[model samples]
Target: MSLQKALLLCSKDAGRFILGTRPIPRPGAGQVLVKNIAVALNPADFYIQKLAIFVDEYDFPAVAGCDGAGTIADLGEGVRGWRVGDKILYQSHWNPDTAAFQEHTLVDAVRIAKIPPNVTCEQACTLPLALATAAIGMYADYAQPPGSRSGGAALTEPWAEGGRGKYAGQPTLVIGGSSSVGQLAIQLAKLSGFDPIITTASKHNFDYCRAAGATHCIDYHATAYEQLPAAVAAITDKPLGFVYNAIALSKESQDAAWAILAPNGTLAVTAPPLVGKANDVAEDGKRVAWMSASVHVGPHQDMAKRMYGALTGMIERGDIQPNNVELVHGGLAGIPDALSCLEEGKISGVKLVARIADTP
Candidate 1:
């Protein structure tokens, strides 16, 4: 077995991350081995480490990372149309052999997007986890238990036939528009021909949101979460049909989003739906859907593959753009501190990525 460097979480809750070695994994059936060049840090990495949430969910000493961009090193049996040295960006699951914290990992071929010539490895690395979160929330279809919020918004995906520009002239709201997922939501909304795409962000990120196709930008600092509904109301009278709450970390934001949603509209969130029984449909036809955003997950596979299949062309045509990138020094070792930056709310409007080659 060949060895590779990895960042290890020796235990749950309080384990220090150790720079260690693991075997370079081989691709299995329908999988491909990628030699990772860059990996992006996400908020989940912090929560899992600080809260010990999914530690027992996978084998330890855990290797934690979800977003990666790299070149294919090998192909599994039955895999075609891809070969060694193909530039690809992909999302990985919690499986130790496939996690992104190492130089090499196996991924199902369907989960990857070829990196177009215009996109760099760092920018490509930011797309997997965050983009999936937004795309799955807004577009993926799945069944949910009655009154449960474990599914997607079930809207028409822009990648599907007639999905592009399907919502023309309608208004859409993306809370926390400067967030990684929020940025992608704004782009996807634009791709679907949504008009007057409104989003809330710091005044500083107003242009940032606009670059991603947000037509109207609200400063969250000036307008508090409690005031968000009215702020959105002032932007467009066309019934607000879709609201993607990318920063669904609080009850206040969730409630404000619910208030802005049309009776028949869908409120999609990154966290559990907790805005005043908002997940349950009453006399009103309003709905709330929370994204579990893993492309490898059973419910997300159909839509995930559709999006991934179209991703290369989207990038080439300039329909989708990468989030702002902030480079973190020290490669895999730098990820722990980068995760801390995420936990402290220090990073905004940009994805923090570390080049695997920078590990020292």
Candidate 2:
């Protein structure tokens, strides 16, 4: 086994991170070994560090990271449609060998997507987790039992038969439109034929949001959450049945979104359901779908496979775009500071990324 540099959370009891070494893992069947070039930070990385939420299931010195973009160093037995040296972006799992903080990681080939010529490794790194969060929240099938739903609007996916332009003239809302996931939601909503795609963001990010396909960008700082319903009403008379709240950590945003949703509508949230009960239905027939964005996980797997299959062409054709990148210096060493920035709410629309191979 070969050693690789990794960032380790030494123990569940510790609140700090340290650099360490781990064995470079070989890809299993249907998997690929990627030499990570860029890895993006997310809020979940901060929470996992502070709380040790998933540590109990792991061995000591757990590795934590979820978004990575790199070049294929080797392919597993029986893998197809990819070759060594191909640039790819993928979502990481909970285990150490598959995590993104390491210099090299193994990913299921089916869950990874090729990076188009237009996108850089830093830009592609920002897409996997955020895009998965948005796509799974908006398109996955609705479970038979509402409580068992895998957290999507169950909308017709634009990649499926007759899915493109399926919701023509429909209106949709995306709270926090300038955020990574929110930006993807706006674009995906546009592909589904939604019109009047309204979103909320800081005034400075209005142009950024519009560029991602949002028809209107509401200045969240200027308009209070309680005033959102009337503000949306002023835009269009269409029934508001769909909402993707990318910044659902804010109770006020969640409440505002729920208030604006029409009867029997779905509100997909990135955070756990804070505005409503996960297993319970609301009185007005509105339902909250809590997003669990992992391509390698349960119910979401099939949908993600289809999405990944189409991702290359989507980028090649300009249907999908990567988020702006703010590169962190010092490679893996700079990750802690980036995670802190995320924790302190300092990072806004742009994603923070690090080049793992540049680790010192």
Q: Estimate each model's TM-score.
A: 0.97, 0.96
lDDT of 1 by residue, 223-310 (tens): 9988887887788888888899999989898889888889878889898778644355646888787877788876678778888999
How many clashing residue pairs appear in each of the predictions shown? 0, 0
**Model 2 regions more than 4 Å off:** 144-149
lDDT of 2: 0.88
Q: Each candidate's root-mean-square deviation in Å?
A: 1.5, 1.5
lDDT, residue 80, candidate 2: 94
Worst 10 residues of 2 by lDDT: 141-150
Reference-based TM-score, model 1: 0.97
Best by lDDT: 2
